[model samples]
Target: MITSISTQIQLAARPVGWPRPNDFATVQIELGELAPGQIRVVNEFISVDPYMRGRMSAAKSYSAPFGLGETMTGGAIGRVVESASDAFPVGSVVLHQFGWRDVVQEDAAGFKVVPEIPGAPLSLYLGILGMTGLTGYVGLTAVANMVPGDTVFISGAAGAVGTAAGQIARLLGAGRVIGSAGTDEKVALLTEKYGYDAAFNYKSGPVREQLAAAAPEGIDVFFDNVGGEHLEAALDVFNPGGRAALCGAIAGYNSTERKVGPDNMVNMITRGLSLKGFTLGSYLDLAPEFNEHMTAWFTAGKIAYDETVVDGIGNAVDALLSMMQGANTGKMVVRTAVMADVIR
Candidate 1:
């Protein structure tokens, strides 16, 4: 007789700073019959993001910490192989938050049905057409209140959000787009691929100097991803009435010591600058609006997205580590199924 089983990665230990291989454990569980409203999904792709690092810690945050010994969760795109609900029948494609597993058995209420895009990979739901793309849109439109002809500056310019933000800023009528990345190669891609007007390697010189050189006219908007020194640098050169959407602080995610706040915070008062930190949850109400624009841009071939794919659910832990270390060029994803398993 055949049996049903699922493979999942569970948090075994909390990290003091950077996560380690020992922090996670992969286990196989025998699957049980689905309840009346539940479904069985086989994940095609799963996302590994910077925000997941914060979830690993036990500290109180905007989102709940991942429970110890429980399977880790994030965004995933999968096909419903079995379903007990009329809402989602067999062969349906769905998006859900029950990731880090090769297979998931969950209630239909948590899963959302997504329309299949022709000639598009399901992984796009975890990147450009997903939260990563929405972050850029929200930061530019709602948080920073971007206006046409505003000069925009972005830190961590080659990561998923940064790359999307640069292009989105252009589409919104930015006069100039400047970005800073860790490596020279990423810096080149920021301008050549992402349409940034000026791109610099943060490692090449002091951030303050590099940013000033890149944006001599001063920036009207700042989309921050890597905080710490980058935040201070933005503050130093912001024009009067400048606005910033403070998104992530990857610079301090793994620090054992407390990271210091920007030294030039007084600029906010003097320059009338507005800096707002946001989580995707607070801006989720804009999803319908964002999806409409993103879909249009994608269909018109105006928007471009890149994915750094690591094969197999077994390497999910390694993929997360690599992403944290900036090993990937764009959105980092783990492929749970082989090509033959994916219908789309």
Candidate 2:
């Protein structure tokens, strides 16, 4: 029998506006033994996302708030180290919502075993091949109803979902794909690497002006990640009968004051545009479809992705804050020290 000490991060205080490092606390617990039907895992990658900021708040949302003084939960991938269940033996890779911990000991039912793809990093399961990728696929195909030759626009285009959205749009036979990022370097990456037809740095000029210059013919589909000015810009440039998928409102995630909506909302009535807001929970039924397409695209070498990894469980809160501030190029994840010993 092997005993292990798991270092876990707990939410100490609910945050107001931007979360501070003091809002979280790190604690260690000894895993003395595994009970019946239990499995122990050493986490490799833990996901940090924009949606998590919403969970930190006490307000009502699509998901329940994280309990104060409890270990936080989100997407994580790891390999089983010990197991009492035959279904999940030692050495099996698994994905779960155990989150922010270097190791986890839980019932086997709480984790799902996933295959290890040869030559691919297991961390990919937390990003391009996982929920992040699925979000982009569903937002474009189902929510926005993007079709062949439809001109598409994506805000926050250098981030995980945004990068995936741009490439997915091109593969879906979009006539043109435009994107907006926070920096000039990201704008270049979008055009050179992610297959975006045009990209602009949102900080350079007004979003509406940049978008209008990029898409002179007007956009038919809008995959919105940043709201506020970006949404207003989309509304200003949308062609008649345009459709939009409201995937996230990252722009105002940390705003202490109530955010004002897009001023050009009346364009929806005048131009007969359709805007639908969605949370991934309601659309999880499309996972199979998403997996099929994403797997094929990835296998065929049509997908490109990036990950900004923060090393150690202690830095998880810092990683999340950096992602919200547009510091990460793609999906931002935390890599535990245990992951360093295992390359694959």
Model 2 bad stretches (over 4 Å) = 1-3, 342-344
Each prediction's TM-score versus the true structure = 0.97, 0.97
lDDT of 2 at 32: 73
> Residue 258 CA error for candidate 1 (Å)?
2.4
Q: How close is candidate 2 to the true structure, as a TM-score?
A: 0.97
Tens-digit lDDT track of model 1 for 1-344: 12258889999999889899999999999889998999988888899999999999999999999999999999998888889999999888899999898888989999999875565678888887889999999999999999999999999989989988888899889999999999999998988888889999888899999899988989999999999999999999999999999999999999999899999999999999999999899999999998888888888888877789999999999999888778888889999855244454
The lDDT, on a scale of 0 to 1, for candidate 1 is 0.90
RMSD of each: 1.6, 1.5
Clash pairs of candidate 1? Answer: none
lDDT of 2 by residue, 15-125 (tens): 999999899999998987899999999998999989999999999999999999999999999988889999998989999999989999999999998865555688888
Report the C-alpha displacement of residue 170, candidate 1, in angstroms.
0.9
Worst 10 residues of 1 by lDDT: 335-344
